[model samples]
Target: MRHARNNELTDRRSAASDAKAALLTAYRAAKTAAEPSRSARQAERISLVEAREARRAERERLKHEEQTRIVTLAAQKQAAIEAAEGAEIEARNSAENARISRVVEDEAARKAERDRRYAARKSRQA
Candidate 1:
């Protein structure tokens, strides 16, 4: 019985050592095989990140351009409005000047008529 128990213990130790050696060999193979896959995945992720950043930058540029276009349009509209308002003011001033000239001419005609009537009446009395 003692010899049999010693044999069983030896078998267990040998099996455990063999298992350890097989696990080490498999780990070495997996380590060598995994490098290319890991590098490829990392490179792919970096490229995707770069593409997204470029797209974001392009979108920002387009947005800025749109804003600039809108501002330019607004400025043009403002200039047109100012020009139209200035023309309207000039027209009103010209109409008022014409009306004042007509009023002055009418007053002169009335004064001349009154002087002529006075001179004729004085001559008749003499």
Candidate 2:
């Protein structure tokens, strides 16, 4: 049943194609006849010019759209990369701060020890 339906569709499509082809041939013959009617010639010229202009405009619109999409995507990717770099820099700064804090603590402990010894010796001498 499916195959029969497909065959029917194919036949219908061919019939339409043939009809279209015949009409096109007849139109061409009428246009080229040794003495074409003034209206027929003018209509053909106007249609051809309009079709060409429409196609040119469509191509320009498609090209502009494609360029805009490419630029927008590139900017988004660049922004993502910058954000990642900023995060890495912030992590490095935090690590350095922690390291410096440890060093400062050790220096303060040494100063306290030195002061305690100096006071003890001066009291014994007095």
Candidate 3:
């Protein structure tokens, strides 16, 4: 009877080990069968990442261009303002110079008239 019990226990243990081995083989077969689809899914994920990166890069490029445009416009505006101020200053200086020239001409004319009067007086006295 003890030998019979040992035989039964051995049989049960062997059957359980065989079932575990079968389960392991099934898992391996399923993993192999799904490998192609898994790799395809990974490829799809990679492409999506690449597309997202491309969009981000494009957006960054556009933003940079816009900022550059804004900077250029601002610089142009500043230059125009400076040019206008310079023109105004030149006009003011020209006006001041004209006024000074008129004053000097008037002074010279008065001096010449005084000299002529003095000469006439001297000739009359002679």
Candidate 4:
């Protein structure tokens, strides 16, 4: 009876030890198997982050360029308006000078005719 009991105890202990070793081996194998996939997932996440940053930078650049374009166009439009106003003012001044010149010429002719008539009348009276 003592011998049988001892044998049974030893068998149970051996079986328990084997089960523990098997569980450890399975855990190690699973960790090894998942290592490549885990690293791949991390690399993919890093690439995605980098791509997002690049897109944001591109958007910022585009926005800046658009603003610059808008400012340039506004400045050009203002310059055109100023040039047109200056031309209009010049035209008005030219017209006024021409009218003054015509008035002066007409006054000079009238004065000459009146002086001639006065000289003739004086001769006739003498």
lDDT (tens digit, per residue) of candidate 1 on 10-41: 99999999999999999999988998998999
Best by the TM-score measure = 1
All predictions: root-mean-square deviation over Cα? 4.9, 15.7, 4.4, 7.5
lDDT of 4 by residue, 1-126 (tens): 999999999999999999999999999999999999989999999999999999999999999999999999999999999999999999999999999998998899899899999999999999
lDDT for residue 26 in candidate 1, whole number 0-100: 99
- For candidate 4, the lDDT comes to 0.97
Question: lDDT for each of the candidates?
Answer: 0.96, 0.92, 0.99, 0.97
Error of 1 at 48 (Å): 1.6
Q: Rank the candidates by TM-score, best first.
A: 1, 3, 4, 2
For each candidate in turn, the TM-score is: 0.67, 0.53, 0.65, 0.63
Candidate 3: tens digits of C-alpha lDDT, residues 49-112 = 9999999999999999999999999999999999999999999999999999999999999999
lDDT of 1 at 103: 92
Query: Can you tell me which runs of candidate 2 are displaced by over 4 Å?
Result: 1-39, 109-126
lDDT of 4 at 51: 100
For candidate 1, what is the lDDT?
Answer: 0.96
State in Å the error of residue 22, model 1: 9.1
Model number with the top lDDT: 3
Candidate 4: worst-modelled 10 consecutive residues by lDDT: 104-113
